[model samples]
Target: MAITSANQLELLQTAEAVAREKMIDPGLVVEAMEESLARAAKSRYGAEMDIRVSIDRKTGRATFTRVRTVVEEDELENYQAEMTVEQAKQYLSEPKVGDVYTEEVPPVELGRIAAQSAKQVILQKVREAERDRQYEEFKDRAGTIINAVVKREEYGNLIVDVGAGEAILRRNDKIGRESYRPGDRIRCYIKDVRREVRGPQIFLSRTAPEFMSALFKMEVPEIYEGIIEIKAVARDPGSRAKIAVISYDNSIDPVGACVGMRGSRVQAVVNELQGEKIDIIPWNEDLPTFLVNALQPAEVTKVVLDEDAERIEVVVPEEQLSLAIGRRGQNVRLASQLTRLDIDIMTEEEESKRRQAEFEERTKLFMDTLDLDEFFAQLLVAEGFTNLEEVAYVDQDELLVIDGVDEDTAGELQARARDHLEALNKAALDRARELGAEESLISFPGLSPQMIEALAKDGVKTLEDFATCADWELAGGWTTMNGERVKDDGILEPFDMSLEEAQNLVMTARVALGWVDPDELARAEAEAAEGDAAAQEAEA
Candidate 1:
């Protein structure tokens, strides 16, 4: 084949046809053809020679040129493509470094080998351009739903053609081993669109909680219009799911709107999910109230939440225990996921037994340490005094309010509690020292003696060790590993150390050790305060 006068426009026609077929820019296809022609020219002339190709966009006329650049003697490396300024002077009136000289050349005839190579190059470039076009079209479409045609199954993953391109629905992403035949039309949530080496990989999912939310948004007008917002979703894939929604308009009930008129809207979503049971719960600002809603179909007798620990305990009647936990713990697991909290569920009798055990333990602690009788300790516990610290630091008026307690008795109780707490602190400090805690860490302002002991046991025995710690390392936090949240137990977590508190202590240690500038800290604090004030003003 050759770029003959009769067939010159063939290149333009082919480029336009390929671009239209692949849905890519026609110019990109033309550029790919030019590059392929240039490579063929290089193979014919000489590999080291400078050869370039350009095609007229409108006329499809191909131009071939042999070019050389003038460079300094020391920089001239490619003998065929580059020449020194002195040598370049022969070709021009005044030659200068970095000047390029080009001359028209005869187009070469294509051989069997060269034509095959050019075809491969054009195909590769077209594939890349197609991938880029597909990615640009779908990148912003992630987290939304799209209609697709089932193309084929590869290793249990569905390769569905989504009009412009193909996306993968992994085996795990399919709900309940769902199978589809070729040419079957399906809808899927665009979980992610990533640019990979071979091409842009579009990951589709039906099991993601967001997939259900997307379905609801599509089915319910209120949700689509932003009148109702789906705040949280938890799915057992094909089995069951829980959704929490809130409505901005008081006239519209979020749950009722999501459920639709006689469940028409939710039923559409349910059909898509293979009849997965959905519990549309109204979102509550109160976490415990929301939890009660999340654990639906089971009457909750009580909900005790530990906000600091991000955990909640629910008490139910004996008959509801099995229902609340669901078949194989599915209900509770989805509820936990929906609430973003760890949950502990028990029957009311179990809760009562646990509460009695805690009361007995506290009573025993007071009896042994404060040197009080069982009856007095029970009275203190009944009045909500749980530990020696609370009793020691509480006002004398609080003690006087208890039955059979007056000024003298209150004073005696405070004195005993303070003495016992002091003794416990001393023992903890001594144990910390034995565990190799330095004076600097022991004297750290924010840490208690028990906290110091805990740190010492964990090898954070020095101020330097404490300063090098991350806030999350000192205050427990959750980590998502392999799609599950795992707790990272902190050394000082048991002492009720928050991340903020840990940060303050670490910064203080750094300042004391001359590692941080006090003036800089003050400036930073002032700047932060100013920024907060500005943000507040903007909000107002």
Candidate 2:
């Protein structure tokens, strides 16, 4: 390609056209063209030679030059890429190291192959620029709805023609029972914009909960204006969905606004989802009240919340059990997701039976372990003392408040509880010793007799084994034999150690066994001292 002045103008015009068509900056197109021309020039000038090209932005004038840097004789690694100060004097008056020189060269005639290579280079550059532009445009637009046309389908995934780019709607992200054909207009949530080697892949989703929330935001002006807020959403996808909304303005009902006039707003969303049933319920701060609303259309007779377990036991009338549970437990499952709590739906009869069983179990435990009569065990169980731990920990004053339990009786009961625990600990220690537990592990600070026995049972019988134990392993992060993690139901076995206590025990064992360097121990002591000083200062 000869760069005549007229042809130079054509080159600039071509760049401008391609930039406008590709939605990229014209300067980027010019840079690509320059790079392509430089690549072509290298073929004529020899690949080892330093060649550079530039095109004037205003004048459209093209220039090609060979670049060389002046260097000491010893520094001239490549003769074509560098020139010695002695050789530099041939081209310039001053000869110095670290100086650059440029010599203009006449433009070369392009061979057919060279021209094609240059064309490929410019196309690749322009394609890269376009991908980057699309990525920048859509990356921040994730979680928002975008309208597109179905351009084609591949492997059950739709290629959507979003303006200036193409997006992918995977089969799994499509609403159940929804179908699309080529050129079909569709709206999808922009799930992600990923930049890959091929191009930016914009993923779209129709069944995402965020998609439903966004639809409501579009339909409800109050939500858009922040007068109403969507607290949570749970979906069975295409079949049914529930959304909890709260209102900031006292006069505005959030659910009513989301439902719109005679359910027009929600119906629009439902139509878009192919008739998915939607339940719009008002959000409540009280968990029990919120659970009742979540289990809507089902009457809840009572709710027993186990806060530590993050579970709720909902007792319903016999007739409402199936309704509360829904078909195949869908109602309670969605309610759990919406409220972020596990919901156990039960009939009143089941709850009554469970309560009675629990009462009997606690009574038997007290009667057997505390050596109490059946009546006394029942009395303690009735007073809400579920376990010996509670009996041992409760204040004497609180125990005295129980019916028929004077201060002397409360004291005697606590002593007996302590005695039982001590006997159990002594037995555990004996068992641990029999299992080859080291005296060092038994005497380790922060290790209780029960912990020692647990460790011995698990084959962690030595001081080194105790030192090597991770805090989570020593505390409560173990998965059960059934492959389930020890959850809030309770800590298991050796994992019953508190994190702080476990750390202390591990560090003490490590130091006692010489597993840690003395310098590290000193540093740890200094850090602990500093931490304690800072804490004392904060308290002050």
Candidate 3:
């Protein structure tokens, strides 16, 4: 029962307590120390020496055994004296130079080595266990907001202690007009949790799009409940941002709700972000409306959309041009991003100049390139004939009867009129189709594809065709399939037309035929009917 002093007992007890605190296995620590002591003893006592150490944990006592290998001859100085066959038999039945015979050694060497080895093993295990624990602690906390204190500045970024880990908040995440000092407390959204060689690494941001979004979720019940949706966000982080919001409930005003009363809701978010300005704009599908809203504080008079160019020409009053364009063009620049358009801002004066240039170009074409002779051109010009359609679609007979023309001239004018009139009429019909007039008319039963195609091809493309076809058989005995007679009332519905509508369409057709006075066609038809009635009255 050789018991060591109290100092030796204290050392061993401290080692055990440290192993427990650092979560290191006490058995592993003991095994590592034992291996180190055995190696140290062999080095000090010679390679052929065998040393065994035993520990008395309760009494803190340690003992060592020493042995020497038996040899056939004295090949090395440290080897035991060459044992004769009789000597080897007395010591061991079978002993070789590579094998050993043992005896108890002193406790001093084992005690000194065991204590040093245990200290080294415990320190290494503790470091590794701390690292593992930190990684596990931070891994579960990713994507959560955390409060942190600024520790120091490194490479223009803030090193913050976020409870279980150290986080880096980059410079760009700081508000433009706001800053932080060491020891300041701040709230940040956790962006990432990563493992590093030293410890758990966390990344934080205060300017991420989701930071504002998360704040809104905390402040607004609708956002948390998913009643409002943030469709898009264009942020000049730390200064201003445009958030396009939409409501899932039509009855709700998304922008108003996000803005809150007196802007308390959005203001809360802005305060968290250090008074960064936020604009909550309602999302609109209409490009013009959306662009107008995207450029806030700047009123737009008109937006000329050039979709093919992927640009819009915005006209603002002379005074508003600078405001709309913003300082350094930032207002329009952000608006362009928000609406996804290339905006060209123009003041009223510039726009007026553009319109004047266009007007002059068109005037030159009409005056110089148009086929009308100087005298007739001047007459048409005086009559406000800025476009050829004015003359081409006019009533040819009416123009021929305009006091100065004879029968031959009238015939020639009529021929020219017909050519131009048909061209203009065909162009108008093409435009109407483009404008969706054809789809609107397609549902009428009598206006079947075959009939419509026939009329379109025959140049009977107006409701005037109804008048011409009044005597023409539309179906069996002039009765269409709907049992409607080929009278005006009967055929109007098929074409989705009324009598007045039919008359107007005929007038348009007549004008396109170079008949300037469509009213005369109606008069001629009425006179023809009156003469027929008079002839019938005489016969009766």
For this target, which candidate reaches the highest lDDT against the unseen true structure? 1
Sorted on lDDT, best first, the list reads: 1, 2, 3
- lDDT per residue for candidate 1 within 1-540, as digits (tens), equals 999878889999999999999989999999999999999999999999999999998888999999999999999899999999899988977999888999889999999999999999999999999999999999999999999999999999999999898999999999985779999999999999999998999999999989999999999999999999999999999989999999999999998888888999999999999999999999999999999999999999999998877889999999999999999999899899999999999998998999999999999989998888999999999999899889889988999999999998889888998898888899999999999999989888888899999899989989999999999999988888997878999888877789888889889999999999999999999999999999999999
lDDT of all predictions = 0.92, 0.88, 0.66
Runs with alpha carbons beyond 4 Å of true place in candidate 3? 1-144, 194-200, 305-310, 358-540
Q: Can you tell me which runs of candidate 2 are displaced by over 4 Å?
A: 370-373, 389-419, 439-448, 462-540
lDDT of 3 by residue, 143-196 (tens): 667899999998888999876557889887776666779999989888777877
**Candidate 1 displacement at residue 155 in angstroms:** 1.3
Candidate 2 scores a C-alpha RMSD against the true structure in Å of: 4.8
Question: Which scores better on TM-score, 1 or 3?
Answer: 1
Instruction: Mark the regions of model 1 whose C-alpha exceeds 4 Å error after superposition.
Output: 532-540
Question: What tens digits encode model 2's per-residue C-alpha lDDT throughout 232-319?
Answer: 9999888999999999999998888888898999999999999999989899999999999999989899998966446789999999
Which residue pairs collide, candidate 2? none
Ordered from best to worst TM-score, the candidate numbers read 1, 2, 3
